[model samples]
Target: MSVFSRFFPQAQVSLVHCEENQVILTAKNDKTAESEKRQIRLIDLAREATPATCNLNPLLFNGHLQTGWTTIKETTEIPIYYKRKIFEQEIPALAGQFAVDFVVPAYPKTTDPEATDEARKYTLPSGLPARTTFFSKEELAALPSNDTKPMLVALHGLTGGSHEVYLRAALAPLVLDETAGWEACVVNGRGCAQMKLSTPLLFNARATWDVRQVIKWLRKTFPNRPLFGIGFSLGANILVNYLGEEGENCLLNAAVICANPWNLDVTNIALRSTWLGAEVYSAHMAVSLVNLFNQHVDELTHHPRLNVDDMKDVKYIHEFDRAVQCALWGYPTEGAYHRDASSTDSLLAIRIPFLAINAEDDPISVKQAIPYDEFKQTPYGVLLTTSWGGHLGWFELGGCRWFTKPAANFLNLIAKTIDLSVTPMPEKDKEGLYGETLANGSIHKPSHPSVFYPVNRKLSMTIDN
Candidate 1:
């Protein structure tokens, strides 16, 4: 003990030492030769530790380090754990499940270059007041004739409005990718009162019709280009359902659906509330429809969608379900509608390469409720589940970025599957997230641990009935 205790007192001196010349070499600076040597050693160690499949491209890294594309498609070995979140179906509507995913970002999260009113709305569909929004996309706009680019349709989630354009702006990030080659159009569900929607979301499932309308409109206007659809939550379900239900009527060749629920019935049962989920969704729809009715209530009592009388003292979802969804969509009851409107059950027969990603534990998108057996069997559709993405809220736990890699990778996977060329999530954004809600109606939720019911659980949810 005394022989080794001279200058190296309390030190083993055997593991990390050299007895050659008694000279010590210490790293002097971050970019010093020693530091660079250590960096190379660390890089080599990292490479040695990496899995066989994780192909780290030194060339790409060098390029990025030189050109600032640090967030490009860097390969990682983190295996995919399918996340699936399930939400109960709307009462009086079908039962289902919805999930959230970390799909890649094809759009730039910045102010979109195409967001400008490049042209103008010169005509109104169905002679409506050109109500600025609705539950899904509409093919009513004339595509920019002078320019020939693909169309990117975006659908907003529940309680959303044109008043706050951030949701739409977040999506702007997806379409901004130069390789995607598509223009974006944000959809306002007819159920909200804020965007001046043309109708009521009472026809929740029928929202697919509106999305199809938009696609059809785009095809007519842009005849030569391809159309892609991207929808969040309800919008996703609506678009997927339309593509599934319409089969060949859909003009879309590809689509990305995030944080969606299928099997309306199962989803309704998976919520934190008894029927509060359905009640909340339905009540919001009722109020929006009621507001629209109120706008012309005295003049159009016979329009036959939803009326001032049916909403009479309606409280729970089942009650409102009987009045609104049933009365509007021609269902005998909400129970019947729930059976007919489930999108999960309708996943088969979809000819397009549709991608559905959701979290396994989303409060709204219940995962176990999805018909996985069928999803796995579908050749035209793909279901990629994540472990923790919440509702379309896939932001990394503390940071904001959530949907970039997942979406980009999914798009790339599909491109490979379908033989198309494209890039991964935008290399420009290292910050940001993707997500949803429906029309304005009477619903409003600001941000946070989005508590579902009591209209105000610690004050996260709010809807004036």
Candidate 2:
């Protein structure tokens, strides 16, 4: 051992690194007990070796404490300037339209004659007047092509957007540092970050359609730039699903998914199983959902399928999904929606380098919900399960998120290793991720395209509830 290592021995940990064709395929006849045992084995063997270790503040060691405490913790001191850009997505929604807003770092302009530091003061521009200095589609289209610096596209957690403190904190270090030479944008979910819902819909776990359009627009607008994606919680789930659906055609060179709930069914079960999960976390989530729903009640009330009255008694997230998400997404039952929306199956089809960071002690996403075997078998997937970090709470000594530096480093590594000359061809299927086979054996197509078999190859089969 080296002298430094001998003096202060480094802590050791295990990690699951999935290589191509390295999966332990399960037989159809395998018993449930056997599967459970295999999952347990995977968990025991896998460990985290991330450079950014979770040395949380001594007072916030507990999973629940780490999660709950960080939400209210003061973290606005991080200096990062931001401006907004809205993409008019032509998806199926009210008035035949939808919108996605991206919060991009505001770098000091060297070319624009009128650019001022005051123009970059606002980190979030969602509620600002329509006539603000925010860049419009035309303005962004006219910008010079940038193939030199890497681009990081990020997504936030449940009911969160660019304005969220956790989102900004994770982004500050890379975007603010000129040496990093990295530019970033945060894709705000519909009706999030004080943005009004133009349609009768709110974003759900299965809401990959919105992200897909944003990514397409991004690629078209900023062609040839090295693009990477990083998502937290709900956004992670959406990004994973998008990757899986796109398969080799996915535009981003690499992706990082943090605190993702691989299986929504497991997440719902875990939440209701404990008093803290149900009363505190799930209940709080339900309140946020209800508030978002109330924001567009005028438009939503006219929707044919939505049971607006049913939303009144939503005390938990599942209930809110049943009342709102199920109807809008055409799910027959809440369980069905959760089953389909999950990114567990999506892991099988991801063609890019995928790094997933989860905390074993995360209370909301819960350790049990993580699809260890799926990640273990993914051809380019790496799972880093830390000993402690609750939900999105990975606070270090000075209130900075432990995952920020590591996430940026991983994206940078991918940019360096991958060939940036050729863009991967995307799968032609543009509908959705799931489809049904009728009794007659012909494929049944829904109003919203759901079933996707990646190009000519199928990675995994999704069971419809």
Candidate 3:
């Protein structure tokens, strides 16, 4: 059947060489001018870039099928190998100071599976706990080998956190494995991952300060081990922006950005273009956003700029941003917020070895938004795109998610290749790409605020000891 033929979609990878702005193509179907490849061959580059074969499930054949199936599928397993410790981080934002959770790994004294059953018993309503074992600060520190492993700091997508099936499926195996010798910390954005946010401010695409704080804290806490970063969807956008903002001053040894909506403007348009995109994906996401807003309605309603009552009418994802993200962050409009928040411009500034993966058929993170030219210019960055794998869903022959294996392999390659002795540039010498004062004394904030709130400058931390 013609439909069955689509089950085995080939990978399409692209990377541009900055000099002369030359474009490189991988797949045979990629349309390029005959003059486009005067000196270089534009064919079959994906096979060399990724090892994973994209044999999509016969049942989940199309983009919408792959996307829908992956979300509802019950393949995500709770992490059972490691203990969890929640650290409360206080960071400054436009609205005020807010405390966010930094869920990290804490090891048990012994590997007796039955002994830690109660610890793993800590469960969420979703039945997939963000973490399995629970430990206090002192309790974690008391363990002999708790603090000496390599670190992987992860960030989840919109309205998602450590509990996300995609994240747990992709990350838990790599970090929780004792033989891998790695630990992970999921930086839960305010009001996400079941954390109750007190401040009116909710996280947006440009919310990188909290991530910066967590990364810096991790560096301070574990000065001896190497550090890596991986961000999914919205988290990927924030992580990339943070990497660009930090530039030479970022402490990450390597990073992975998966299913990143590189350009928010294109993504917004794509969501509203089709019936399925608008009715299903956008509507679903808007409801999730509204639900998150409802959880912190008590705190958010009191803000002078926010009309919490009116937020109930938000129908589209962009409308939700216009009502909430714009009001809280002081954006004049949703367009301005999307423009400032997009990571397209930030890709070229990144100096660390990183892999950027995307699906050509991602319904939400539309392929049109993929900055092919920008990625080509980024020397340390690699972009891998599959012809299938809708959004973050890459179900293979036996329902296996394909992206995780390649991601882990890429991170491992980076760990082996990079020099660990090198450290980030000194603070004074480096510059902040966002929320900083320019040389001419003009402050470059994320947006122009119509209403003023006390800017909380203090940074502090409280571990759930």
Candidate 4:
């Protein structure tokens, strides 16, 4: 028997990539790679295959598993599974470290400006500087002057900027699609990735003002385009809070959040309580924050509330947050900052379709910190928990990285659902009546003055007679 027959005997599999011991395989009928096919065949195969074992719920393995997103059943407890080897490498909080050690650094780097067609800077009302890098400008320009496409605005994680690996992964699916007419952009937070901060204040999980400003700008810039938000880690926390704070008034049509630190208090405690968390994760984060602060120390020293002496002893994330984050933001204590900044309590207020994905083995954002009950109760919120993806390190065999495809799929699904062409009808409705055929083969009449009708789901356009 071949590798496919031996391992996945029931399914037709296609090999995507292979290098030495690593082999990437996918379902034969995967839509994303329909045009591409690999010629390699599995020649050396054994009769007996080792049974794969991991903590991932068996329910997740069933079905086609296109994007690896298992719909949350009615149960509150969600089970996540990882391939045995992947699980073994996923040491809570150290998964990323292991990935960096083994995985070749072939992902797009910060120097690749081609990822975005244009870059624009905005100074928030509070004088904090932020930047937006846009994709698919040429495609947008080709459309009619009044026509607009759906836009996805991504926010990077802690100490990450627009050019980070996750942002690139999120952008890869839609940025080059001329037919889909989808546009993407990144919202770089203040003082990240060498960006100069005009104000002394750096963004935290509660700093929704910068994101709000970016959304407002995107709206003003492209008034007709439907907006969607995708945030990772710390950025995901901020997006979740912003959605809850805005409630029904939130401008986003939908959202996808991955590896969010829903409960900062629990996350901070986890980071300090364990050897892996303290030495690997917290140390890395603290160093990045310290470097950023030191680069802007001259300007930060002038801020009335900040005490530079307190920052000297900050060796861990909790200490850093207490000395600088809480102090700069005017929170009396670190506990107060973590409590107030957490998005878990705020999830209930979100009214728009929101998907939050977390890994149970995630070292930094402890699985216990996830608010599954709240997620289940929230009307528009969907939670997907996997057993083994380590803190944004969802790498698979054969060079495939997970998370991005599912995120892109979610974005596309929501983009199709939004009604983009709702226009005012003329006084004589009957005179301008026109029949438009929908995907379901139903005729939609836009003759009525105030009545809404479904148009082609694929194309968000509607006819106003």
Per-residue CA lDDT of model 3 for 1-465, tens digit only, reads 466555555555444333332223222222556445222111122224367456668677767888998667754565533344444445333433322333345443555554345234432334334334445556556643436466788888999877677877777557666577666767777777555555676888977767777676677777776889999999999888777766555688778899999899899989999998888999999999998888778878877899876686799899999999888867888888887789887775565667788988899999899988776554456688877789789887776788887778766544543335533222122233223422211234555564221111112211111
Per-residue alpha-carbon lDDT of model 2 for 209-293, expressed as tens digits?
A: 6666667767877786777898999999988877776765677877889899888889999999999989999999999888878
Clashes of each: 76, 9, 1, 4
2 against 4, candidate with superior TM-score: 2
Per-residue CA lDDT of model 4 for 165-204, tens digit only, reads 5566566667655566676656666666444455566777
Ranking by lDDT: 3, 2, 4, 1
lDDT of 1 by residue, 1-465 (tens): 565333222201001111121111122244546335221121122122222221122232221121122123212222211111112223223222221111222332223223212111211222211113211112113223546455566665544432223234344344555566545565555533222222233336435544544556557666766567777766677776666644434467567776676765566555425454455444554564455445544433444566768767775445655776676556777766655666665565454556666656455657666567666444445566644444544432223334444444444333323322221111223111111122211223446454321111111211111
Cα lDDT, model 3, residue 212: 73
User: Candidate 4 — worst ten consecutive residues by lDDT sum?
Assistant: 95-104
Worst 10 residues of 1 by lDDT: 11-20
Whichever of 1 and 4 has more TM-score, that candidate is: 4
Identify the superior model by lDDT, candidate 1 or candidate 4: 4
**Local distance difference test, per candidate?**
0.43, 0.66, 0.66, 0.56
Give the Å shift of residue 434 in candidate 4.
43
Q: Which stretches in model 4 have alpha-carbon errors above 4 Å?
A: 1-145, 417-465
* Candidate 3, position 342, lDDT: 90
- Model 2: lowest-lDDT 10 consecutive positions: 39-48
